[model samples]
Target: PEKRKIISRFGAFHGSTIMGAALSGLPHMHKSFNLPPLPVIFAARPFHYLDGLPGEAEHDYATRLAQELEALILAEGPETIAAMIAEPVMGAGGVLVPPEGYFPKVQAVLRKYDILMLSDEVVCGFGRTGNWFGSQTFGMEPDMLSVAKGLSSGHLPIGGVIISDKVYQCVADEAHKVGVFGHGFTYSGHPVTAAVAAEAIRIYREIDLVSQARRLGDYLHAALADALNDHTLVGEVRGRGFIAGIQIVEDRATRRAFAPELRIGTDVERRCREHGVMIRNMGDVLAICPPYVIAPKEIDYMVDGIRAALDETAAEHLRTGQLA
Candidate 1:
């Protein structure tokens, strides 16, 4: 049998196409659609802030997750498993960054089972995490990784996959047998999109984009910590480089979140827009992924606006007696 089972994680958002939707593990992405489950198995999300055991060390948590993955692969039969796909820093999963040693442990598990590791770099690619790819920052040795969004800096929309030499050899051998690989979408390589992506790469090289993102990322995370780390409603502020996530909670002590009807994330997003910053809100997590070229002043403005939004939202809850 062809290797078919691929491992993804809960709270993941791979893409919106049929196969991508099947790859995704979020309900919102599957809204209004009745698609059957593909051969994708969902593993645990690396949400240490929420899911970590009380007082558990980060390294131990990573080991536990790796053991869990191994259990899945064993039960499913490793030979039937093709690859385990993951975002280096889970973007749609509220920018969830795994425990410090998580990827290496997970990669070890994959190696034990002879399963491939695939990095979904759509959101964390191209200096988002202060590196050319989040995989580099996190030390994930992926057999293949997908790239988009930053490929053309959202200017024209293009994506490509890079494969390891082993995978390439297999592909080349198969293509030799068939004359050419017959895998593609109608717009697989639109000339204009390719040109735009090429230009984006050139500009990135010209400006030393990676180092710039690394420096600015440090400042952005520091600013966010200074502003919101101790806020009453903020459960967590996390990210690297130009990306971040603010976890909102009704009670910071127990990490209790507001009810779904509150739409607290959406309110923060609206307020942020009013104050001239844009944030992507997914339920209670407010995500910020500013452009790599953002100045320190812009980071300040964005963080300030989010703080105000949280304050306003908290005040409303207080008035309604939903918060104490």
Candidate 2:
């Protein structure tokens, strides 16, 4: 049996289109369209903070998740599983970064089962992850890469897939026999978008965006830790490069979340907006992915805004007995 089913994760977010929705595991992404059965299966999310055992270490947690994936593949029948798609630093999935030794172990499993690794680099491509690509950042040697967003640096809409030489050779041979590739998009190679993407690449090269993101990301992460680590509502502050997530919780000891009805994440998002710093919330996890060119002082300002917003959220929720 040739592999057909693809594996995703529980908290993943691929896109908003029908195909993308089917590939995604986010609740909102799967809502109400009554999507038909697709070949996608979900594995455990690699969130150590929320899912880790009381005494489990990061490396062990990674191994456990990898084992779970292996079990999932076995149950599905390895030959019937084609590929597993992943985001190196899961973005819409609350910016969930993988655990230590995660990708290497997962890659080992995939190699053993002849399963291809498809990396979704839409959010972590370019300089966002401190390396040229998220795959590089996390030691993932994916067989394919899907890239967008940073490609044109938000200057234009463009995205593309990159396959390895082995896959490309197969595709080329098929195209030669069929006399065409038989796949395309309306704006597959729009001149304007291509030009913008090209120029964006040039700018990234000129400024050494990768190194900048790496250094600045370290500073940003430190600032966030210093500011929010002790906050009553913050359970964790996590991410890499310029991207980050601040997980808000009711009980830090138990890593408990605020009640859904409280909409704490939405409230934090609203407060951040009011403070003039934009952020999005996934349940109670507030995401902050600032521009790569941001300065230290600007980072301070952003962190301060979040601090003010969090403090206010804590005060109001406490007063109303909405949070403990």
Candidate 3:
């Protein structure tokens, strides 16, 4: 049997189904489940703010990450590797946006080694990154595309894969050989969910949601950057379109994160919720992904909420002598 390999990054959240959790790279999902099932390989996520060196151009960072992927394939034996998986803009992993040329370089390397490219666009599809798909934003032509979330804008539980012609044909042939496909959930293609998804896509086109997301995403990024970039506890603010993250640090000069035990990210997230704006906390990073239909005023409200939460958290820490 030809071996299959799925190269995922740390901090990804694909879902909690058995196979989904197994494919996940986040330790929290695997703590008690003993996941990964022996076929998945974790790779370095291209997080410029947290990992890219100062003075390195975005293109250089992308090229280096591609090289690292090539090395990993060789070490694992390219013949045994089947596929590489990724989110164009990492979501649960702190809204990490890839550096310039990242996807193209990775695609080139994967093509060279006969490995399949799988784009897990669960959080990035349907205009989240100002495009129909994040793969479009990053120049990735995946052999398999996984999508959910914004497909129906959370109106239904629907997710599925879009496979390239070659893979689809192979699976079809295998099914014929085996007498049946032998794979598919009872709700694989539920009629109600399909109708809702079709309606969602229709509305998105009628309203030009992609372009709107682009315009609004730009405004949102600028608002957050201007308001929070120089804050005392904000180590970095980075993202694209409607998704972004504000990384918190204990010492800005040293780029040291607060101790995990302190749970600064969780505290700030709680504060944002109290203000009626829900944000996600990934370790010491605070992430936000507002709906594409959000208004300019909503963007301001979101930023203000984050700023107020950060200020309140900082004051609390100072009072406790956690910061001097």
TM-score for each predicted model, relative to the true structure: 0.97, 0.98, 0.95
Candidate lDDT (C-alpha), each:
0.90, 0.92, 0.87
Q: After superposition, how far is residue 97 of candidate 2 from its true place, in Å?
A: 0.7
User: What is the alpha-carbon RMSD of candidate 1 to the true structure?
Assistant: 1.2
lDDT for each residue of candidate 3 in 133-220, tens digit (9 for 90 to 100): 9999989999999988787889998998999999999999999999999998989899999999999999999999988999998999
lDDT string for model 1 (236-319, tens) is 999988888999988898988888997878887887788887889988899888887778997888889888888887888789
**Predicted structure with the largest TM-score when compared to the true one:** 2
Model 3 / residue 292 / CA error / Å: 2.2
Tens digits of per-residue lDDT for model 2, 93-139 = 88999999999999999999999999999999998989999999899
Clashing residue pairs, candidate 3? Answer: none
Candidate 1, clashing residue pairs? none
Clashes of 2: 0
In candidate 2, which residue pairs clash?
Answer: none
Q: What stretches of model 3 exceed 4 Å from their correct place?
A: none
C-alpha lDDT of residue 69 in model 3: 91
